[model samples]
Target: MSSAVLHRDTRFVPKKAIGGQGCYINLEDGTKFLDSTGGAAVSCLGHGNEKVNRMIKDQLDQLAYCHSAFFGTQVSEDLASFLTESTGGKLSKLFVVSSGSEAIEAALKLARQYFLELPTPQDQRTRFIARLPSYHGTTLGALGAGGHVLRRQPFEPLLAKNTSHVSPCYAYRGKKDRESDADYVARLATELDAEFQRVGPESVCAFIAEPVVGAALGCVPAVPGYFPAMKAVCERYGALFILDEIMSGMGRCGTLHAWEQEGVVPDIQTIGKGLGGGYAPVSGILINDSIVQAMDKGSGVFRHGQTYQGHPISCAAALAVQKTIKEDSLLENVRTMGAYLESQLRQTFENHPYVGDIRGKGLFWGVRITWAVWAETFTDLYMQLEFVKDRTTKEPFDPQDRLSFLIQEKGLQPEFAVSLYGSPGTVDGIRGDHVVLAPPYIVSKEEIDTIVNVMTRVLAEVFAELGV
Candidate 1:
């Protein structure tokens, strides 16, 4: 039947998820599937978490909506304080928004405004340098700031021209065979410096990047010293360092913030997904004290405003999520379970011909599929299937195959009954496929075993179906 709501895929109607508990979701037909990806790693504590639900309800009962421009609510105030305190006062100001994309928009504007608010207004500093294959958000400003080729394709004509892209510090693809980690980082730093020089360093406002790349490039983390090197480049050019930790922060990377593990602090940080843990649509920007002081000394106000900037209910939900993470000691579980998950994945796919690389941090892992050459030339059924290879190298598969979709489809079958996050265009904007797995922090050893076992079956079935 025709529906009123427009779905992601208009051709197919999805099954209704009527119930969920812990790490499992039950459909209307009573089929339960393990939520291995936590709905794109948003449900950190998992579904039907009583603590978060209770807080949301309580906030609704007490005070649901209050425009930030008019009045301040305790819920929003407390949430902001909690977040700032969590950062040890490094990030002293919080700008609450409803989604990750909005947070990014705020960060971009704030960074630019910060320059303007300086004692000597840097009105010319209007550019941002982000890395390629990164996913920041889909909104116009955020999209302009992002470097995802496919995402930026149709909107190329309209996206802001001030933003340019540099190579991401992806070791798997960027590092040379003989290059040491330090040398690779140095090389990447040099490239970034060159980009700044080409774009005119004095005209740049910030260098935005994800601590651990999410959907756009799968869950790829930078090699050691990568962040410091990049940060050094930004500092050298007097540009703010903006970290898009929307997917990697909020304890998803075994720490409250993914940057903590890298020993670099971003001047402006955006966090979402697990911040509210699927309890509410909430995201925020954390601003450094220095930026805030600059603005305070100047116009004494940020030049941006949103009607629902500090939605009380969203803040309450996120507060509860953070409190739970702290009280239950979930980050410990994230580390323990993250190690177990990585080990299990390595053991299962280490010898699998189709599996090329498995890399991630904490609970977020990405399994990159083998390139087209391996799949077509080495696999048994190369001639039977319609293979689409990269025109230049004939290596990676063409994006037209929808390989990631097939893996996700097979994983959701009744036999496997699992949910895995699938992302494509891993090699440039039109090639490569990878599946990302981000289980909830509360996942158990047995649950990890189930996820890996089912994924193994899913991969085998998908490959067989594809005649590979």
Candidate 2:
């Protein structure tokens, strides 16, 4: 072994990625694995897509990069047009950036700028209210906007001030047993209203959230009427409503925008992940007509700008990704296969002692495990047979339990499925984990069946070893 310059984050060894294509990865050590989580849900079309690669090659042939301060490229403009066109006329403007975090930073800043169009000066704006356990981004500005306590703890002192947090519409955890959906929605709305009052509604520029709670909450959609209620409250205070669709948009959730599923729409939206399909790094903000009109009449130039705001190559790749989705009619596969996947998972894990929750929409799904849920017990099969048990099966903590580590040690590539979307809850960021499963949009129904079969067997095998 040779010494290399060391970086931080002890999560993984500094290994080289040898090759990857179509939901699989090859390590330099000759290990192969399925990328089910899609590289933190970024690779919607999978890796090494030929069309996307070809488009990048074509863009490089024309021009690779252009500083946004000087010229506006055609590729970027067309990509923006595609984004707005997909939104069905309401979202009319797009601003591109190189990453999701940048997109979020722009969204927050743009909301405040939109309010500046009012006679009130910028100094009058000082507050941002976001949902708890939601992750917006890593930059200080975006971090300040986010409410994931674990991610923000280290930089708490350095984060910008005047940011407040409110409850997320995570009905799975937040809703009381006796509470009806209507009552739950009303309660959350009241909480939001109370938060605005405390923060002084006029001082609040925006209320931000993920349409589908991504990493922090494990692919949870809000209860019915949640978004509409939230939107109504934001309108009452003249504050912008921002939806972070970075993890749930661009057909990953079987919709162009997850907000489309809700009765109401957001004033501004942040999208990435599925945008470039991992062919190129790109993210952006979609501003609604009202916000754009405000800026058009007030100060025209948005206060925020990035050096690589509209990278030609990234835009070209994203354009190809969008085109492939349209031509392939992949959203049909996503919806049909999503239902099939849900059925398959429910069947495989329904009687299992450890599976607490199997919930999500479209291709985005998660398997939540509680401390009381142990897979090995195989106890009371009849008791576990109910479709929606809503029972707690506390997971076993043997202190020696490390199932993923065992899988890695085995070096057996998953043929039926990519890697599991794994996480621990109630134990901070690292513990109390569960696995996530998000396959490619082009995934066949047979592929969905296979993923469930593999996970069923894998977990069973792991638990057998643990003697649960």
Candidate 3:
């Protein structure tokens, strides 16, 4: 059969998914694959959750759509209130949007408008600073703010020039040998400060970063004190602090908000993926009181609107998802299950030759693959040289090999029957490969064991086929 739909990769049409239940996805061919990565970490509640389904159905019966400029829906307002209250008023307002990218676009625009509405109107603040090797979103404004090299490459000329990059707080690669966590954090803070100065501190709008980097860096969590230091730098420059939690927040990291563990609250936060538990396309931005107050006093308007900004069905789905998490105590399960998953991963692959680093928080984990073994004694420059030499050193696989994608393909086979989230460009923006595991929060110990077991066989098979 010829398909008219344009798929992500035009070269190959993907297998059709017929249904999903809990942690497994059923294909049209009758194969059931374990969904260990939650479909890009979006299906936090897994699939076919009855409560969320019922909520959406109910909302459909009531009101399905409402244009933000003309009318307001109770579901939208309720969802916003739930989110802001979940933050304990630290983030005082919410702006509903349809996807993570749209959430980021809203954040960027709001940040710019926030400054414009200030008493003195710092309109000169047009620049945004984000970390390298981070994924924000695909929209033009969001892409410009993100630092993922490959994603931004083709659109480089079209992207806004207002955004600049800085080195991420990647302990595995960025930290020098024998550097204490404090010194490492200080170095990053100094670098951020320098970037602000270089870009004219007074002209910068915000310094945006993901609390736990996803996709581009492969689930890298910053070392302790990292965010606090970075936030301090932003505060020093009077620039807003924006945290992109599209992949790592909404209880994905064993907390309602990933920043809760970092000891810093962002002035503006973008959330998505798990927000609606895959039942609906939904995402939003959490704005702090100061920014909300500024707009309230100045323009009393956000200066932005989308036809589906507060779509009723999407809000209902998200509201139900959040309520389920709280009532069912899924976060407790996440913490317990996350610990078990971490231990299992370490026990299985801590010494595996192809595996270089294991990193993550909660159920969000990444197994970084490398051809070379890493040692604590190696200097930063020495490591770089080793990577250049490829095999027999702690270097990333060649980009052409597509090791991560191959592993993912293998996981879907009947022999493996697991859906692993494999990604490339983990080292720089195009060199390294890694597989992320973000099973549903409702996942069980038995399911975790199955995921690890399948991954073990899948990796060995792929590497052996490559003769590595």
TM-score: which candidate is best? 3
Model 1 C-alpha lDDT per residue in residues 279-382, reported as the tens digit of each score: 88999999999999999999998888898888998999999999999999999998888888877777776556666667788888877776422211110000
Better of 1 and 2 by lDDT: 1
By summed lDDT, the worst window of 10 consecutive residues in model 2 runs over 378-387
Candidate 1: worst-modelled 10 consecutive residues by lDDT: 376-385
Taken over the whole model, the C-alpha lDDT of each candidate is 0.84, 0.74, 0.86
Ranking by lDDT: 3, 1, 2
Candidate 2 stretches greater than 4 Å from native:
2-15, 120-122, 371-390, 393-417, 426-431, 461-467
Q: What's model 2's TM-score?
A: 0.89
How do all models score by TM-score?
Answer: 0.95, 0.89, 0.96
lDDT of 3 by residue, 90-115 (tens): 99988888999999999999999999
For model 2, residues 1-468, the per-residue Cα lDDT tens digits are 444546553454555678887767787766666666676777888777888888899999999998999999999889988889998888999999989999998988888778788555555776899987778999999888887777888999999987888888866556787999899999999999999999798889889998777777667778789999999999998888999999888887777678888877788899998888888899998989998887888878888887788899989988999999999888877787777777776777756666666667778876665433222111100011111122463432432365434432322443433467554332333444456677788767666666667777777676677675
RMSD (Cα, Å) for all candidates, in order, is 4.9, 4.9, 3.9
